[model samples]
Target: MAKRRRRYQNRHGNRNKTKYIVIGIVGLVIMITTLALTLLVKNQKITLKAPWTLEKSTRIKTPEETLRTYFSYIETKEYDKMYELINEESKQSVTSEDFIARNQKIYEGIEASNVQIQITQVDDSSELGAAISYDMTLQTAAGEISFPNQAVLTTTKEGNYQYLIAWEDALIFPNLTKTDRVKVSISQPERGAILDRNGNLLAGKGVASSVGIVPGKLNEDPTQDLNQLAELLKVSVESIEKKLSAKWVKDDSFVPIKTISKLTELEQTTRYTSDETLEKRARNDALLSIPGVMISDTQVRSYPLGKAASHLTGYIQQVTAEDLEKHPNEGYLETSVIGRSGMEALYEKELKGINGCEISIVNEEGKTKLVLASLATQDGKDIQLTIDASLQQALYESFAEDKSSSVAMNPYTGEVLALVSTPSFDSNDFVFGMSQELWDSLNEDERMPLYNRFRQKLVPGSSFKPIIAAVGLETGDINPEEDYGNAGLSWQKDASWGNYKVTTLHETSPANLENAIINSDNIYFAKTALKIGSEKLQSELDQLGFNTDIPFEIGLSKSQYANEGDISTEILLADSGYGQGQILVNPVHLAALYSGFANDGNVIKPYLLYQKQVQPQIWLANAFQMENANLIKSAMEQVVSSEHGTGHAAYREDIVLAGKTGTAEIKASKEDKSGTELGWFGIFTSDKEVDKPILLMNMVEDVKERGGSGYVVRKDKEILDQYFGTQQ
Candidate 1:
């Protein structure tokens, strides 16, 4: 029985062991599960990432290829597989076709064998967005070119970087050779012919037979060589030498020589060159051969009209070092042609074409071995202007005797028909390099031909009366028949000119807006302007294009707005009444202001270009029809057609002409009483039943003899009457 009990106890122990094993297994499983949970939770917490961080940085191998491909697609000139990858934002600015054409030259110049690019830096901007910098090396058969450039780009969702945009060289590049060299020639356009409104050539490129030398080709001293060259050209040796050394930096072995100068007249400089062969040959041997120079063909600038449109057309001048630095991408060289002013400066891109190059081989001995391929230089486009040459000549002839200015505009289109400023100088002076004496003489002249008097400042005087009168009628301050007694005296209280009595130029009493305008009665208009007050009158004038500068293509003068708030009422009334006290004007201002009467009441934006259209029944039929323009025209008609109108001298029944005259005072001194007067006339004419009118503004300045008189502007009536004829 004891044995049985022991056996039973052993069995019990075994059962207990089995129970512990089960518990151990269960605990181990629970611990392992807990650890795994902890590890998973920790990993999740550590790996949290931002949304933007999902993107990957990318690099393009061939950046120029990317740009060319993209530009082609952007320009819409080619259907390429790469175009599908364009950025969304860039599509808005230009069409694919235009984009291709714009970059046509740039792409054509690139060759796969010559391309080498070095990735510089990746940059981010807060405003301008992302961009990448690059250093490029272009190795062509002729030579190797290196440039630093940048491309603006954006990263895509797919993590690829592409070319967004690029730019060309901004600073002027140094010549390939290290020597003093020059190639002087004239510039001509082959695309379109430039002509005046009268069909006369204003500017066009003409060929001049020329010869130039590479500095290395010269055998003798540059100075002595230049001296010999100057003697051949019949110009001062100093001038020729100065031009040769103008922008040159001295270098070893290579000195440029220009043996044959530009043709003064295209009529066969061959005679000039041929006649002086022995002399030129001696100079060439003495000056050029020492340096191992080479001959080259060059371009130049020409002004066919010479002095006719000098100020208007402007002229070309040598590019300064500073200019080259500023416009590095301009591809300007020492011998490059630049438009200094006028239309040349205005449309420089159109007037300047891409420069091409040649790929020729040079032997180890520094000799050109074989003829190589070449990319010809492009000619600039022609420019046409609105100037009527005949009319401009006539106006110039008339105003040549004195300091005067005239402007004529097409009423319907606002195209300037003719603009003339007297005492003009030859534009050729700048091109040929004016002598110090001639330049000094022009500068010393009191008339100041360089000043565009048409744009000069002046007080409108009585010409302000017509504008004020129109404002009075428009704003209901005065009626057409409203009577105003001038009393031939002061109109504003405390006015500086109060003590001085005004005289009535015409026989009239207590006149209305009609009579006051006709006689140019200072008192009547002063009272009218005062009655209207500064705010009301200013508002009206501002609407009439008086306070603001009108939009026009050419450079314009700013119209002076009186500081009515700061000045006294008496001053305002006196100055504002006669158009003298606070306001300022120029020829352009008068012409535009007078247009209000010519166009009825509508104030249209003045323009010079005519938008050409097709099909007469469509847009062409309503091209120039303006509605509100008539309101201003009706008022101007009364200023000339009415019996008491101020511009009766301009009245022409056949043409339906109307205008106003003004004479402003120019104070001489504080105590001394000698001063000048300015004369002005603004006219608008209708030749027949028309959609628009013809406008003219004529001004004569510094008329000292007619001091403080109202008749100065009126004196032009005889000329106007003769030129325009009696319409009535």
Candidate 2:
């Protein structure tokens, strides 16, 4: 014990009190300061360079955690963070700035979306690094892409993850390299053609002259030259100037002003000319001689029949942004065109061909490294319609300076021969890009040149008598010899609780069903409808295609027997019998119903798609009894053949003709005289031969003072004469 005490005292004494204590304190303080500096540098709280630099501890705990963090940064588009997660060798190969820009361009260019990454496997046994296998999927403009990939994580000097991404271009996309290029090549498809029954072009591609001007090549004062050019092109000088000074116009650019259809010999001679030449060709040379005015041949949508077939073919316009959004992945581009109206719109799928798409990787030598996706180009289909171009033109020209709608068909075959709407505009103008002023004029015109009247429902007036006559005969309401029409210009079915009276233009005695139909006796048919009763009347009309849309390729307003499908009053039902009440009929549908007379009471459904051999399709069977339909057909034939017949003007000595006439009064009341009349004339051949017989129905507006139904009858005769003459 004494030796231990002595040793301890000696050790304490050797310290020399304050001197040894001061030395120990200074050493302890130096050690603590060194430890703090090392920690600060390691945590990045303080930056030290060269000999004093310290490696940071791993912030990411495990290889799996590191993988999640790396991918999470990518999902969040933290580009700088993504670059930082790579290993030293990868960083040396691709700088942080290059890596970020490269990824951003590729992703945005492809319109990448719906990114999803799933880790499939991970291997961290190697002391050198860790490896992760994953599946990735992303959507692109062309299609969806999915691939399996692997990411190698090299061992890092610092951080808890102990590994970093060994980055390469292949990590961004499967089989991609730094020197490779991603390309998307799109091939445009040619639009389809619209052809007539005989393979005539209704809407197709043809060469036209595109007129433009190069600003730098113009004279110092180009007003006079531009004025002359405008006059020849039928455009305003201001429009030419505006196009020349467009925002994208350059000194060498050819700023287009107008596209003029080539006045080829094949085109129908236009109106306002000797025999309707499109335009005066004498000015074309003068237009070309003007300074800076240049004409180039360009392909455009051609309209051969011009105004004759414009309403049937419709037009196409540039694809709108809204269309692109609504039809994403439909293979549409900015350069695409879309059908806007008429048969073009109804058969858009058959007209808009599929475009080609190619997504591939190209190497430095511009050789394809890999074809990611490829689709072959598909051209649009040619749509053929059952229309006779000659008949269409003849029908259109029949309504010169008149507002009219006409439909011609083969009564037995139900093949529509022609559909004509007068006061029409050139559809080619729309395809060439319509001017705002021209468009305004069409909309603001009181005549309504843009109106598609064939698709509209109009009052049939006396033309509806044949249908009522059929109804009466089929239901045993009236006999052909029994007289229902009285000898008076007007008659009333009872008092009807009002002063309304059924009036006829011509009074005849013994106005039986056949005679009533021939003279269009309003009271006789009115009484017949009352005898049929409202419920039965509606049912008959329904069977005849009222209140239902016609099964056709193009959309037309449905025919209606009443405003809301019910004839609630006797007066209403009586008025409807003469086609004057709430009854309205589409020209096409009415024509189809009239076809039943020639088809033995079977209403044949009309079709527009061309077929080599036509087989009649029944729309309504037993619409009328065979004898009743034949009786109506016989009366219509007499109406044209007999001297007292309203359609006597349409009579021809060489061929048998049948017809019915209607004059619809658009009046506020029964006594109103200051109203326009819609004249209707339905004519067809009743010959026993029955080969290629044509049934034509035409309607003319504002015919009240212009000769009533006679005006329509005369026009119908002229059209029929020409059509039949051609057939002969």
Candidate 3:
């Protein structure tokens, strides 16, 4: 015990207890002070690097808050609300409706698939702004997906950091990120003005003041506003109510409900009530607020002559659900002026320009609190067409007599001077949507006004006679002066009794190609077809741009030619020689083929668009000249110049017009004259001064029993009258 006590006292006594204690206390205090100072400095400054080296020390957003704001939109189907929260700048560039519509399709297969988000890295004190990295595990209906997203948020003058517009995250989802929006305004393009070559306005988008509506801005009764709107706009109350209800449901804020369009002073003054004027105390308060019902500036599409260029220009319609399915990103609201047909459909891309948008913030009730993004709407581009409105009007009037069609083209350039489809409907019917009554009438008419008959199928008849004669002479089947006995019928059929017979219009027999075409002698041409054989004849015609379809801006029916495999007899040859049996051609195809005659045996492909200036030619290459094309031109010229010509009545010595006429029977029942025949006329000028021949072909279908000939004669005359005037 004494030894133990001595050891303990020695150990305690030997050490300087106060000094050791002071040293240990000082070491502990120094370590704590170092840690405290390190933590204080670390928490106070955050270093971050940006694209532009923007640097700042600021409080960072928590991962939870970011995820809540980002994913909350997916949980609730409030896509419009979600759009509002996007960086204001981006919101202005994108259409809210378009975004919602696009997301709706993507989200249809995704539900409550939790998105796991984690911040990986952050850079501070850099000119590029705050760099944030996120790791996300997204769950979709297809499978679980994971990806990393990053962005740099730039600091504004308010010290609040906003998203960078050109970043990877912005590319993937521009509407969701805070740093991806644009803040610039847009200027709408001026409304396009349409003018003819002579500077006459036929169709144009004109500037006219309009009334707009903001559905969220109303304080009065909905019915009162509706009634007031109806009285002001001179429309039914039901229509205003419907429009208002739609605006409310769609939640449109910027676009106003138009109460009137292109209003007169008298019409504008009638909007006020008598009670407001009589009561002096309430005069200032007479104009009650209405949601979406207000006057504003707007552009309107107008056709100066109303229906003058309806078919060629076509019309516009609001994009439907089908359009949305085809273009999910374009959205419904912005795609209002879709081209319905004609030139409008062909040039849609050039016409519709960039769209403008705005980003706005709304409260829980869907009230807009702030505009987060903004840009003005841009206007569409303008197009100048080759159609001549005045000539179009004149042609329209000429074809008004009967169901007929006419097409005029410059043989050299292939520019269409006139393209008229007869028994036509007023284009105004399609504008603003057609009425059920007019739509039914258009569809029910026997004339088939909607059909572009110039491109429709028809037997060429005697118009093909010149073509057959040319084949015979080229193939050495017949000499120019070869004698062919009429016998009142072809070699395939006997005409002993002269009952079922073909006859020459002239009493004497034709001695050459000129005489043959002049009288349109069926017997001579029919015999020529037999001698050359249908195979060789068809080959020559096909090579000269016959029986084959020609390509254009619109679809066309192919011309029909008898295949060698399809025919085996002289009887078929005889019928085809007279443009019957199985031969059919459109006026445009035949008119183009006739270019060979004027072009000195070289048939040029028919075209609607100019080639050298445009990247691609609108017409197909079906043009070629056979070794003996002159044989055809020589004969056709006589049909108009010769005294005994079938087209003698149409001949003009002054202009030297060469042409061929045809009449094809349209049979219904074996005994019915109730069927009509199509009459055709193809013509061109013979003057040397005319560098290129002008070609015109007109066709009139369904003239029967008026005469034994089964052709519409007056309609053919009307077409010739116009052709002569225009050609001159």
Q: Model 1: which ten-residue window has the lowest total lDDT?
A: 45-54
Score candidate 1 by lDDT: 0.56
Query: Each prediction's TM-score against the native?
Result: 0.60, 0.80, 0.62
Q: All candidates' lDDT scores?
A: 0.56, 0.81, 0.58
lDDT score for residue 467 of model 1: 69
The sequence of per-residue lDDT tens digits that candidate 2 reaches over residues 510-571 is 77777787778888888888889999888878877787779988789999988875999888
Best by TM-score: 2
Put down candidate 1 lDDT per residue, 526-562, tens digits, no spaces: 7777778777777666655555565666767666657
Q: After superposition, how far is residue 205 of candidate 2 from its true place, in Å?
A: 0.9
TM-score of 3: 0.62
Greater TM-score among 2 and 3 belongs to: 2
Descending-lDDT candidate ranking: 2, 3, 1
Candidate 2 global Cα RMSD: 13.0
- Looking at model 2, the pairs that clash are 58-159, 58-160, 269-276, 270-276, 270-277
